[model samples]
Target: MNEIESYIPHFIVHGRSRIAQCECASCRAQTPFVTNAWSNQVRHSAQIQCDSVSREVLFERDAFKLHTQPSSPGDGEPLSAWQNNVNQSCINFLIVEDLSIEERLHATGVLLSRLSRDDLNESDASTPQSIGDELLTLAVSGVIRQRFSQMPSIDRYKRDYLRRLAKVHLRVTPDPIASLAFNLKLTELQVMSDGFLEDVLREIESSRQVEAFFGKHGHVWTNYFLHRCFHDVFPGAARNAYDVMFLDLCLDLFCLRSLCAFLADSDVELTEESVSALFSAWHRGGKECLGRDDHVDPLLVGYSLITRKDDRYGGCHER
Candidate 1:
């Protein structure tokens, strides 16, 4: 096995002798990697506890390291050690702890009622307004803030988008839904947190103004990109929750490209100092800033990905 594939032992259980099915049209049509016993073990481990067995198989650490989570919300780590770091106070301050059902209902009601304004269109009813004031109360009642915050980019994109949704409605409710969420029982709460994000993204995209706004914003246009990424390339029940996130990143690059285009030809001119400050402010939030900011390019490292490969920023530099 190659070094990278070997590192991801979950995919290649044994060295090479593990049996695998190639029934998937794509897999059958292309070169296949063998799945080892460890893949099954990891799968089994996920059924019970996520980190312990996966760690044992990969030999990263005895305790969990909380690697990248595909659908993870803010503050959910596999290993407690990797969690509880203090770099995120600003974000956390904005993030409220999980509240009881009553709190969630209260918050949801506030958000919904605020969004229900005289300015809304018929389409808003299905999306921004569909989330009834009642559901917020329900969300708060059983919510527990997810445990780890350093999630994979894919998951973070989804969370940031949701957080933005909450923030937009925060005007409606003052207190937002949050960029973070309670670690709810997956068996039940997944429909509320994860499902809700998916639904809102869809409804917004379907609206006439939203579609036009997206068109004007170009790629990486928040709701516009999200709607296309999820519905077009990666639809519901993607390979995993993270799959949705992955496609979002792909679209994010399109966003970066769009940003380059916008800045290169903007009528609004800022001094180089302003550009530099915007860059630094954006980088301070680290990667989280990329997915959320419409004004900032997601390519903060001054790098770009070409052909699924990491390529440093390929755009022309100003003289």
Candidate 2:
């Protein structure tokens, strides 16, 4: 066999073994072996084929490490029990709740920097829709929201960094609930696009795996969205009315009613008349805008249709 051809199997073996090792030092050492093997194989000749092979092997080795290595704890700190139990890639995500906003953003940046194209591919292979949900969850947690908003305004560099990281995470991870959660949180941070919210709705409408994910986590998702909308998205400001409308269309009847009740309980200026008008507009757009059938709350679907009919007939309604 040619030198490059002979080294391919050894490179693959070492690469796979390095991926399987959870220890930091062992994994780091094994990575160089794969790189050095390729370098040695191509040392005698600078042929195009040998150069291409070297590039491919090194890319694969980097991707493998990116997907498998856990975030190392800070100096003097040890890995938590939860970190040890979960997949290495998820260690930082699992600990996000305990971190301050600054620390959380730093951790998020570290995690994002480690993600590779191979990790996205692997996520797609395992779960097409909920890919990277755990990491997305960390980005949108209650602690993140509270801390992010309470802090003074972000500088341009940090704002740009967060915006880019959030965009990349959304592009690679297609989890519908995570998309909503992250979009709302990022919107509060003033680092998100209106187009992203629309894209998230489209993802929910198109992915069957998202339907299943919603069935299991629907309540939690609804609660997160509701809390954010009341506290951040719709604070009775004139400029926020448009955001309120956007969120209204995104929600179904149950969540819409919950939002209305929340607004009523608070001193918000959103009246029942305004909410009803928003729902009417949403219903006029039909199911395509409403999202996938299974992703919609079953109770909301039936009740919303009934409410629409009642509204059309001018019947007295209390919703």
Best by lDDT: 2
Q: List, residue by residue over 75-135, the lDDT tens digit for candidate 2.
A: 3333222222222333333233333222333323323333322333322323311333554
| Backbone-clash count (model 1) | 24
Each prediction's whole-model lDDT (CA): 0.26, 0.30
- Candidate 1 lDDT over residue span 1-319, tens digit each: 2111112223123312322332322234433432222211111111101112211222221112122212212222221211111111111211224332112212322332334344645333343323332343333343311211111223334334334322111011111231111111111222456667545333322334323322443211222222222122222222222222333344443332322222223222322222222222222232253443342433221111212111111111111
- Candidate 1 residue runs with Cα over 4 Å from true position: 1-77, 80-239, 267-319
Candidate 2 has an lDDT of 0.30
> Could you estimate the TM-score for every candidate?
0.18, 0.18
